[model samples]
Target: MSANHPELLKLSSPIRCKILERVNKFKAKIEFDGRIEYAHINNTGRLREHLIRGKTGFCLRFEKPKKTKYRLFSIEVDGYGALIDTWIQGKAFERSLDLKLIPWLKGYRIIKRNVRLNKSIIDYLLRRGDEETYLELKSAVQRIDGYASYPDAPSIRARRQLRDLIRYVEDGGRATIVFMIGLRDVIGFRPNKDVDLEIHKLLLRGSQIGLEIRAIGVYYDLHRSSIRLWNPDVKTLI
Candidate 1:
């Protein structure tokens, strides 16, 4: 990895597989080693554009046996990998924070995870001196023509979370929303206006307020079973 791109912890060596079909938003049937097995899909987006029937991808087997034996981790799109697991976004961002790889949020230390305030559960709570910062993480998997977009489907929960972040800012605390783009080739990110107009408008309003909005691009290499930061300075395309 270069100075600008930091490597994330590899969970497990990925197994080469092909997606047979999407069982639902949270599950899929995949073929690996000439056997068809049902696996868990962590991403909730309507990934119709990426999760095609015969598309090659990578999956990780469970360390211990569970309801699902495998989890679809990443899929190759146009020779570039797109991470499909939403759970990895927070882990990657937290690792970056610990290593001080993020420039703007370098000195802050994470005090808590899954912090609850009012009705929403923010992703992290950080403190630097007497000031506190509440942070939320959103995983972006939908990409179009080198641009990444969030919320492939309508998200009322996302809207509520934004409202709570705005309130936190209004009450004299710092708040930030980080969009983690999972597509390797994305140059920038923006809210999906066609899918969720309310979220698009809310993101604009939140940016106008004191809520800090940031984005970073990530790349997952199935051949190496590794993840790394692709773009350190992701632009806000709003």
Candidate 2:
């Protein structure tokens, strides 16, 4: 990790807003600048901690025409901000990779983005020498008991991808599953068994079957108003 470029990504036209209520899985009502409006929620996870009423949220104001004028990116967590936007999390991960911040993937280069394998579209494909690895990134914004957790709700898609990765590893192929821990104060990352026991079981099975499991932390610093790469190699609890 380079000392000069610590902040991985900066928010675009960010504004502080108060979360009113989550209208649905895709939309949330927020109050900002003395006005109430709907903001697009990019994450599908059940963010029970961040989406509370009156909780402060950081959002981006989009100039282009869209369904919602604002998009919720991060929410206040113990005076700091916890990034909740899935898109922003992916962007931060890409920036970290480009800067060679992730130590585990030091010699690897991204060959493709959103590559299709079998029936699922994995996040990235990397090559280092003759070895090729299919990598999938999962957002772990749910913070529980000083650890970053995944799938605040049950996700069939995530479960299917886990199965596919496990099978791919079994068939003499290389695969890696990375959990993007989007919090500043997490000790480590782990699968949320309480939310989805099957996912937890599948992750355990995948790790046991030679699937490379890794974790990286990317979080938003409210005081700096920029997204920072908290840790390039966060410990994997599972």
Candidate 3:
């Protein structure tokens, strides 16, 4: 099938030397747990990864992926695992998006693929205001110059999520999307229009209508297995 989005400019591969170059520069310790668990603390989360870096590290952020679906996130190190968050990989960014953005959900339910709804399945199910919700997570990897963008790898599933959310809104259901920007050096999350314009248009429409589109900043302390919002204002790039 023909793609409707603009082609993003070429950049370094995900697993390329650039990754090791960045990781090796860190003098901090490593902390990452390969096992995935159920995301119970938040409504839009399914699993959390424990840091395995000899006890100390924090996430720095993530760069573009060599491919889609790898939990190939970047982290910072200091001494030992602290906040132990992040699970799975490619789809994990979506949860961090909600945890950082959705202010309304101070204490809500986060379930793992409890039930399949439509064409696209959300990683987490959030229940709030008596309505069962679906959520999808994405890692912010691609960027232009200094601008951070989504779909570090092209995702037909992502487009499906957008369409599904559009349908959810039409059906009187609540839905929100989180684009977790793992990069601390960047500002906000923008659609990689070069990669997916349909998604961009749908995202714009979702924002205009009822969909909650949020961009959460990540403060990675890989050595401590911790990530926090370093900025008060979560930026959203249209």
Q: Each prediction's Cα lDDT score?
A: 0.83, 0.88, 0.49
Best by TM-score: 2
The digit string of per-residue lDDT tens for model 1 on 1-238 reads 4234568857576788898899988898999888999888888888887789999988888888587899887888766578878788778888888888888886899999999978899999998888789999888888766788888999888899999998888888799998888887667898889999998888888888878988988868655667888775699877
Q: Model 1 misses residue 195 by how many Å?
A: 0.5
Q: Model 1: which residue pairs collide?
A: none
| TM-score for each candidate, following the candidate numbering | 0.95, 0.95, 0.58
The number of the candidate with the highest lDDT is: 2
Task: Give the per-residue lDDT of model 3 (tens digit) for 48-154.
Answer: 22222332222323445332223333433233112213343323343433554445555556755535658777767877567766766566644566665765445
Rank order (by lDDT, best first): 2, 1, 3
Model 2 pairs in collision: none
Off by over 4 Å in 1: 1-4
lDDT of 3: 0.49
Give residue 167's error in model 3 in angstroms: 0.6
Query: Backbone collision count in every prediction?
Result: 0, 0, 39
Which of candidates 2 and 3 is the stronger one according to lDDT? 2
